[model samples]
Target: MSEAVRPGAPRAVPYLRQPAFWIVIVLLVVGAVRIAQIAALFFGSFPLATLTAIVMFGLFAVPFWLLLAELDFLEREPAGLRVLAFAWGGLVATSVSIPGSTALDNLIAKLGSPDLAAEWGAALAGPTVEEIAKTLGVVAIVLIARTQVNSVLDGIVYGALVGLGFQIVENVVFAIGAVQQAGLGDRVQPVITTFLVRGFLAGIWSHTLFGALAGAGIGYLVVRRERSRRRRVAVAGLALFGAWASHSLWNSPILRDSFGDSVPAVLAILLLKGLPPLLLVLYLVRRAHDREAAYYVGILATVRDPGLITESELRALGSGSRRGAARRHAAASAGREAKLAVRRLQRAQAGLAVELSRGSDGAGACADRVRRHRATLAALGYPEAVEGARSWRHTASTVGTAALALAVLWVALSALGTA
Candidate 1:
């Protein structure tokens, strides 16, 4: 017998329609307030404030944009959880760590040795406290939403966002303090230098790298169910230790001295010091990409039987350059809508690939992904466009590879300059 539906029971509403939801409203408010504050603080008084804000905003926003573009790699529930986790890290984690670490440092200083404080400041205080505080956000996120962090890359993205948030606030403080310390006459140069060095180079490794490293540990624990809990704890410990070590090296007095006395030498040391971890991150991301590609192969097989797409088309869609060509071809024949369809398909293919690689391969899961992909394609008004109509392209891989290579080269060159 069919049960009668209750007349007053609330139906679930789409996330966008739910404007009253606290999370959405809160995020919106925070974004507005932050942007307004940035304008008010930076735009008035200092001539360089506008430029500084632009550079800082670009650095902070780019990562978030990239992550959003690849959001299909994450399942919805997990993705939402991740966003919340990062927000928690940025808000609660930062709040706790700042005061906690400051109090601890003060206590250590009061224990009766100023020289000890200096030594500890470089070796321990900066790295140990900073990394832990930055990464505590990732840890909290992982603890609350363990299923969301599927790969080291996921950890890196989330951790980086958390770190980026911390860095933005920290940078503001440093810049304001610099203005106070040196006054207007000397402020601009130091601020510019700090922005160049810290905002770009150290900023990458600063909170973001530390949080990512710690997040890798959390992700490792979350992904592997066969390992003993103790082993998982060890993995998290090691990752955090690596984070601390990297942070310590960056903050070390040795590097600090090199910075002003010999700028080139300092750059060289930073590049050399930072390369291994960067390489490791690249390797992990590449593997994930490959795994995602393979996942699409499986899905393409199923969807093929339904006549929704062909195997040849699937193969062409696998590569980014090919997809771009397909879009161009469609644009020429079917107009802008066709081109839009191709773009949507491209994203869907990438997302599916990532999801498949991450073991989200049940029929329901696959169907949902395919449905979303189809909806996107339909929205572009080219729902019936053939996948293989255009040749494959390698543009995506080339661009990604080139960018990574450039980053590595920049680090290497910087390191050489230091030497």
Candidate 2:
């Protein structure tokens, strides 16, 4: 994506030349080496445990990935960048954070009383050390391809990936920790139980959420370039603090004492503890999406386009489910080709809107894509359902799948806890 400019604006930084690009390459290289070593140990100790972690994290991560895709429904970030964001989270952030956090915790233990160290060590160091590491992942990506991150939504998406990277690795580490107590029973039991709790129960509110909040701040700084630098810096600082506070609260042992030792009690306590920040972040995400959609929708409306993006397309583009319905409706009546064409058309139009909004040089290419898609759809007969709401089948399928997942997780956790 070439940088869009006014008649004589300064050239945008090419993706390759950006320092952030090299920084990501370096971090990924280092992190890959570190993670491979850990994976070897995990496999050596227990093969099933290693596989379980991978599978569970993948399953747990799908919802998040899907949500991020929805958030970027209009102008999707490059797949390469999104993957790198996840790698930064799972690989780069985790590889560096663990050691850095340990060292800081050790230092705190030496200077402070053992009780104080035990109680507050994580709360203090996690916000300072870990958040910085994860937030940097978001910052680095933004810096590398500054134009790629056009809004707060992009920031949250990248930030969540960084956090997810940390969360998955941390969950695996926790599962691996169960290895030390192998003599207690089946070694795999601890791994399974940990996955159930961390991956299924508390995964959403963990690192993924934290990184998102901080990333949004970074993104705000990028998009609102006209805003005073000091104000932007303050937003970034507050975002980091919000991420840190949530992390500290999650890590803090204070909740353990407040809740009973039962499974239900523990789950309730965890939800209560995690909900505030999660809700706050969710609200922010919704607002970001709305604001971004408005900007792009306005662009589509203003630009010299007649049939490129219709009002119906604009409305459908605003919601993920609607997009699915439109595509599905096309597929149902027309055929596979029609569905594909519809998707491509929407993508092109959305990309065009994004390019126009950002004043990027790639708008022409996007326009070409729209033209191709339009020809294909016209050939196949544009089959579309214009009604606003999603079908009953779609709604049921989504809700039922969620219900089943929660049920299975609860059953597995309860059984494992007893065993």
Candidate 3:
């Protein structure tokens, strides 16, 4: 997970020497203590409901963790850093936002009429406090590990993990509130209903997406050093504003009054509010990924050693689909072992590219790892690269997955009722 420093990239500071590191550690400890106290109260009040919410949201994080981990496959963020980002989100941001958002909402009520605050308080206050808290999680990462925050993709990865942490913890808190509001005597039904609404319906484009948008801004601010400092700060501000605006729109009451609360209406509202930011973040991610892929692939091309990385394999490594296709092709032509070997070879080649980018000799440890994997592939009689094809089986699987997802959505909607 070591990254190459670009010409004029900021020098790394030891974490122990950085005052910001100590500040972050203190905040995390305070947050953990606050969360533990809240958990104790929840357990005392509704043990079964609290446990159910915890378990459900804990499981909800698995796919998100896996998906975000792969976002920067070429140069994966260190596992420790990833955990740190998530912890900041779940602990520091969530704990701070609970009280901060409430206080801001109260302030809104004082400044404006009660009607204004009642209708617009959440839209105004929640995003202001929560987005700032969550965005700071990304800033904290940058302060702690400047070297790891080299690319915009790194920012997106860290931001999304922070958002995921916030989203999960916030959802758990909401689930518990649902139980209390329902007056159902510690029943799990309210928790399940909350999960269906928050986790199933609005999960994708919620906090994680917002965090990523803000993270992109921070990434741009830090990595685009060639730009004027004023311009970089402006871009970062715009990005944070974008994140806040998106979150505010989601919390606003504009659609609720106009569209009613039927299942279809709810779905439409979610899409209307969520789609723009989702599409924007997707475009940013695609652009960032392509740029990074080109840079890494260019580094590998200089070696000109088929034993290390053939031209075709080099091409495949730059693409997500082609990389998967290479492995699938290996499985079809050779055995499963060949498929695994191809994957290992691709990873090893990526490592070598990283090593080369850092001005290391081609004969270093990364190169040795590449040679070992290449030899393993040759032993399986599949040393050369393979191309991907669109097979009938692939098409069928794609269609089947879509069908299953739609079915689940329908069931969830029905279970929750139309209004």
Candidate 4:
């Protein structure tokens, strides 16, 4: 009659052990190979410029991952899916879009006029081509595993990864082409100017944003499976169309005339174009996070054992900063090891809460996991606040990040100056 000896939830299956994981890995490898071949061909034409394009854009790609991760913090998607999303964008989507868009442009030239194809083909073809190509990544993911996306936020994150992948690779191609247009002595200048323009100016509204919007549409279709199939399809279509229109607007030459060339003026126009969609996504994410947190927090009342999760622990999970402060609190009171132990405790509790919230039979198992972590924490003692100076490691990390950002800005400016 004792629940103390009851089993815990099954341990997470290793990614390598899953068949789907291996499939994703294989796909990623194939994509990487294709991209490498293309990059190699480009590099052979002009090595330094191509390499610089990859390196600077490599730096540019980091914030995309970091921002999307932050957006999807509470309910993280599987790492394999995330990798697949990025690969689809970087490798498959980009590879497909370039040739596909070019072919369409050529067709336009034949049908209309050469001038028309050169001037307006991208405005027509790019949105239709690139948005769909990037979106196919999300579709592939959903087809492979339908249950991975539970909310609009998940789709947005996945889409963002795919878009980011496409954007980085695309930027490198642009860089290479820009440098090629310049004189041999003046290549790096163009590459740096490209970095400043693409990475700093236009990047905020690039493929990732388009992908996020389209992915949210896909999320609606999958997550709302109970709805009439027609209704779901409509939502998905609308999301895709929004992405296409956004891309179309960006590509439209009208913005150049209406928005003007002033740096501040251009940024203000971009915000006007970009902010509403972003605000909607953020609002949805907030609602979803709240709904999930409420479910988990509500279940704690039924948990029956205070040792498994305290009220403070339940409250802490609501905000990342609170969670961090709790870890620091644990470290200050107990030892450094206790910090990790406390984190494990929080995670185990969250696991139990998830099982309960999902209506799964694994709640008993999850409870066992929570109890084990509780015992570990009990052995270490409870965390109490202790006043102390900030850790040197934390301070150093902050300083290092600031220095790196400054370095990047200086390089961009210097490169532009030399140009």
In Å, residue 410's CA in model 4 sits off its true spot by: 13
**Residues 52-155 of candidate 4: C-alpha lDDT, one tens digit per residue:** 88899999898778878766454567777787899889988887788899998899999999999878887888888999989988987776666667666678
| Best candidate according to lDDT | 3
| lDDT to native, each model | 0.57, 0.77, 0.86, 0.74
Ranking by TM-score: 3, 2, 4, 1
Clashes of each: 9, 5, 0, 2
Residue-level error in angstroms, candidate 1, position 400: 13
Q: Which is better, 1 or 3, measured by lDDT?
A: 3
* Cα RMSD for predicted model 1: 8.5
Better of 3 and 4 by TM-score: 3
lDDT of 3 by residue, 68-88 (tens): 998887777778779989999
- Residue 135 lDDT in candidate 3: 92
- Please list the residue runs of candidate 2 whose C-alpha ends up more than 4 Å from where it truly belongs after superposition: 1-13, 184-186, 303-306, 328-341, 358-365, 375-385, 389-409
lDDT of 1 by residue, 1-419 (tens): 00110011011324454433454346435644654565566656554755564466456656754653353232222445455545544554555555666766666688947776766665566666767766766665555444455554556667666666666656655665565566654246556545656675565556666666776676666655567899988987898898788776766665555556354565567676776666665565555434434445555556554334556557656544455567777787668777876666555554554444444444445456566666666666656445434333445667889789567647645653453
Tens digits of per-residue lDDT for model 2 on 137-247?
Answer: 888887777767877888988998888878888888888777556755325677777877787778878889999999988888777767799998999899999999998
